[model samples]
Target: MAKVIMTCGNLCSGKSTYAEKLGKELRAVVLSIDELMTTVLGRELGDMHDEYVRRCEQYLYKKAAETALAGTDVIIDWGFWKKAQRGYAREFFRQQGIDCEFHYIAVSNEEWERRIAARNAEVLNGRSDVYHIDSGLLEKFRTMFEEPDRQEMDMWIE
Candidate 1:
C-alpha cells in the first residue's frame, strides 16, 4: 500500500533535498509549499504570509491524501516545526486510512548556518526560488520551531 512521508525539520535543514531523493527512491510524488508559494505568491504577502501558508498547507494536505488514496506514495517536503503539527499530520493520515511516516532531519548549528549561508547566496544570485533567511527571519523561526522527541519520529536523519 502507498503511504505518506512527512518531513520534519527547521529551516534550511535539507528537507526538500531529502524529499527529492526519497521521492525518486520510493517513486512518490513530492509536494512542497515553498515551491507553490515561491512560484505563485512571491514575497509580497508580508503580514498575510502566515495566513497564506495556512491555506497553502491545507491544499497540499488534501492533494497528498488524494494521491495516497490513489495508491501513489506522497512526500510532503515541509518543516513540520511543532509537535502539534506533526500530531495533526499523523492523525490526518490515520483518518484517511493511509499510513504515514515522520522523517526528522536533525542538523547541528554549524551545518544549519552553513546551509543558510549557501541558500541565501543562491537566492541573492537569483539561482534559488525560496525565501532568503535574514537574521530577523532566522530568529523568528528559532522561536517558532518546536523540535520533536525521538519517539515522535519514524526515521531520524542527522
Candidate 2:
C-alpha cells in the first residue's frame, strides 16, 4: 500500500532536505509547496502570499491523494506548522484508505537561525529559489508556527 509522508516543521528546519532523502529511500515522489510556488510565482507573492499558499496546498493535497491511490508513495514537504493542518492531513488520507506518517524535523533555534542566514545568502546569490526570511517575516513566522507535541509525531529527526 502507498503511504503519504507528511513533514512537519518551522521555516529553515530542513524539511525539504529530509523529504528528498526520504523520497529516495521510499522510491516516492517528493512534492514541495515552496518549490511549486517559487516556480510559478518566482518566490514573491507579496500581499496575496497566504491566499496563494492555501490554494497551492489544496492542489497538492489532491494530487497526493491521487498519486497515493495509484500505489505510489509521496512525501509532502510543506511546513505543516499547525496542529489543525496536521489533523486535517491525517484524516484526509485516512478517508482515502491511504497510510500516512508524520515526521517532525526538530531544529534548535540556533541551527534554524544559521540555516536562515545560509538560505538568505543563497537567495541573494541566485543559487536557490527560496525566499529570504527577513526580520519581520521571521518574527511573524515565529508567532504563527505551532510546534507539534511528541504525541502528534510518528518520528522526530533533529
Candidate 3:
C-alpha cells in the first residue's frame, strides 16, 4: 500500500530537497505544490497567492489520496502555515484512510540566510526558478505555521 509523506518547513529550509530525496528513496511520486501551481497557471503565483495556493493544495491532497488508491506512494512537499489548514489536512487524510506522516527539517536562521543567498544567485542567473524569500517573510511564517508537533503528526522529523 502506498503512503503519504509530507514535508513542511519555512522557505529556503530545504523542504523540496528532502522531499525529492525521500521520494526517490521510497520510490514514490513526488508532488510539489509550487511546481504544480506554476504548471497549472503557466506562471508563479503573485503576492495575492493565498487563495490560489489553498485551492491548489486541496486539489493536490485529494490527488494524493487518489494516487494512493491507485497503489502509488505520494510525497507532498509544502507547508501548511495555519492551524486550520493543518487540522483540515489531518481530518481529510483520516476520512480517506490514507497513511500520512509529516516531517519538519529544523534549520537555524543563519543557515536559512545562507541558503537564501545561494538560491538568489541561482535565480538571478536564470539557472533556477526557485525564489529566495526574504528573512522577514520566513519569520512571519515561523510564527504562523500550525507546526505539526510529534503528537499531531504520525511522525515528525526533528
**Which should have the higher lDDT, number 2 or number 3?**
2
Candidate 1 stretches greater than 4 Å from native: none
Score every model by TM-score.
Answer: 0.96, 0.96, 0.85
The true-versus-predicted C-alpha distance at residue 116 of model 1, in Å, is 0.7
TM for candidate 1 is: 0.96
Per lDDT, the best of the predicted structures is: 1
lDDT by residue (1-158, candidate 3, tens digit) is: 78888777777678888899989899999999989877777455677587888788888988999998899999898876565766777778879888777777667778867887888789789998765556676577557755556666655554
Worst 10-residue lDDT window for candidate 1 reads: 36-45
| TM-score pick, better of 2 and 3 | 2
lDDT of 2 by residue, 1-158 (tens): 99999999999899998999999999999999988898887766789999999999999999999999999999999999989999999999999899999999999999989989999999899997667789998999889899999999999988
Return the clash pairs for model 2, or none.
Answer: none
lDDT tens digits, residue span 1-158, model 1: 89999999999998999999999999999999889888889877999999999999999999999999999999999999988899899999999899999999999989988999999999999997777899998889889999988999999999
